[model samples]
Target: TLFVPEGIDDPEIEPGYVERAFATASRMTPFWTEKSRQAHDIQVRSGTFAVTMDGAPIFGPLPGVPGLFVNIGYDGHGVMCSIEGARRLADLMAGDAEHDPKDPFAAERFLDGSNPIPEPMTIHQVQ
Candidate 1:
């Protein structure tokens, strides 16, 4: 679900948004095509704020924090990139030949203070 700000919470009933969306839809140039596949029955929540240094995802063993594993910080690309990311991370943990080096996604990079591009990574907007 898209998290609308407090003022725009009820977009259906909200005056300005209702008119704007109606006008935009009437233009007949939708941004994305409608999906035709059967829906995968699952519950999902959208408020995930995992930050990493390179803005790329971190998907491997939790460094220095032993016994804890993590496959996180895909930013907004988690749904699209998760399949490969999970495979690579699993390979790393299993010490398999297919495991790519985890240097690019090291959690330590966060400590080095390199900021992700297109900054202010939080999805929450400040008024």
Candidate 2:
């Protein structure tokens, strides 16, 4: 049940979103039975977020801001990588020696001219 309100920057959940959600679910999946929909209690949640230029995470220290580390722009995989990502960022902040030299998620890539080519936007790849 992915509800992506396109071009919406407002963090507040809009009115009638629950109805639209159920409708989209039903339309996209045959498994969303009437019984299931009727038995469900809908609760809406919303927030604002930013996406990186290349649709990948921007982790580690922010350039020109000493001691300010960031771990943002995970696209939609924050839940999947939160634990590992946090550990990596913490290690880097603590001056640990085990940090990867070629860290792919480094924030400097945006400024260092090493950013990967941006992918073509699609419905499933919205960022």
Candidate 3:
């Protein structure tokens, strides 16, 4: 989802506060562009970044929760990793895989005050 914030000024966006985050994000950057003046999405603050704890996503049927499943905390690569997440979930449900991939994203890692994830460029190289 797009997840734009309040004070967005794009002509497509009405002049008001964006209360629903998911809806706003849905309308954000339908595609990429190099020019800000031509952008339809509004910028809240520049040079901002998101932090996800160091972990893989929590995918597949959750442990000890009968029939319950989850696919969350995908970090910034959700778009790139969604297929993997779906495959993993499917495998677990179909009895093809033995366990969740890792511990960092186990849904319980954030319980004990771990460091927040850093921004994309700061965390890893793209090319």
Candidate 4:
């Protein structure tokens, strides 16, 4: 659930990123005390910080690639919106629903000019 905003091109995690994560955790939580500075059973995940021009996630079939669907472009809200996108994508793939350009999160919105300008992002940070 760590949602760091920085981007990296390669899979190699920078040592400083870990350092900064520890620093942030220690600052933001009482549980991350000096006694528990070390972490065990770490898991790694890597993915592109994909963003669309309209600042919304895409969930549906690929425009031309048959038998392929995409659930992407969460921008920075993947932590919050991923589950909803998965549900919608499943419905679309199963023929339970159709792509609706009217929905801002729809993948077809880009093709139909329904979503052109980016939506304003609501980013908040703890001091």
Candidate 5:
């Protein structure tokens, strides 16, 4: 997926984005063929991106709100981390695992002023 790094405040889709997307999709894609699909063809989808303050995904419960859990703040790793995140959250809910508040992905880390969670490598590729 291509990341543009912009807020949703402006709801308009730019023509440049469409062009770039079409260009990227047409490059060496096995499923795309001359008879099946055109290189310039593209469909616009509505969606938004979410990112936490420290650029790490948040997992576990919402502090001070018992029984109300959350598995959000994925930013862009939802596709990659969905299964594991779901499993971990489920384990916590089922009492099979424990939640470490100091962990980078912990949902309670945002509320802890004394402890700051470092940004995980998911935010950038190590070059």
Candidate 6:
């Protein structure tokens, strides 16, 4: 996966960029040979999205709103984490489990004087 920097204009599904990435990737590992890269069919898709102020997800109720809850900001790993996130958010909303307002993943973290220092965006820091 390419870590396109934040301010650059969006290429918006540029095939040349994808091909170049595959070419570079092929050179990095024996498993991704030139022929293998060429043979693999590639499909491209695109979207606009937002990441959170801090990298971690925001889960649980919206502050001061009794019936609303939010479970967002998974960065790019929403598919991997959404099941547990939804379960935990449901537990909070259903009152089936104790809900901690100060829980690390809680939305209140941004407002309750508990916001953590934002981490640098790096490949090693992902997840």
- For residues 1-127, what per-residue lDDT tens digits would candidate 6 score against the true structure? 3587654554467658676766787879767675654665666656644456677788888889888889888877788888899999888878898778778887877885654666465232424
Local distance difference test values of all predictions, in order: 0.58, 0.70, 0.57, 0.73, 0.71, 0.73
lDDT of 2 by residue, 1-127 (tens): 3586654665667788777666788788866658446756766667655677777787787778888888888667678866788888888888884444367787767776665766454133524
After superposing candidate 2 on the true structure, give the runs of residues whose Cα lies further than 4 Å from its correct spot: 1-20, 27-29, 39-43, 98-102, 112-116, 119-127
Worst 10 residues of 3 by lDDT: 30-39
Models 1 onward score TM values of: 0.53, 0.63, 0.45, 0.55, 0.66, 0.69
Instruction: Please give the RMSD of candidate 2 to the true structure.
Output: 6.2
Candidate 5 per-residue lDDT, tens place, 1-127, comes to: 3466654554667668765554566576745344235544555655657777776677788788889888887768788987798899999999999888877778776675654544666543324
Q: RMSD per prediction, one decimal?
A: 8.4, 6.2, 10.2, 6.7, 6.6, 6.6
Encode model 1's per-residue lDDT on 18-109: one tens digit a residue: 34544566567543122212224433223435645445787776757776657887767688877888887777778783423436665655
Distance from true position, residue 13, model 6, in Å?
Answer: 3.5
Off by over 4 Å in 6: 1-11, 34-36, 39-42, 112-115, 120-127
Query: Is 1 or 2 the stronger prediction by TM-score?
Result: 2
As a whole number from 0 to 100, the lDDT of residue 102 in candidate 1 is: 39
Error of 4 at 70 (Å): 2.4
For TM-score, the strongest prediction is 6
Q: What's each prediction's clash count?
A: 0, 0, 4, 0, 0, 0
Pick the winner on lDDT between candidates 2 and 5: 5
CA shift of 8, model 6, Å? 19
Candidates by lDDT, descending order: 4, 6, 5, 2, 1, 3
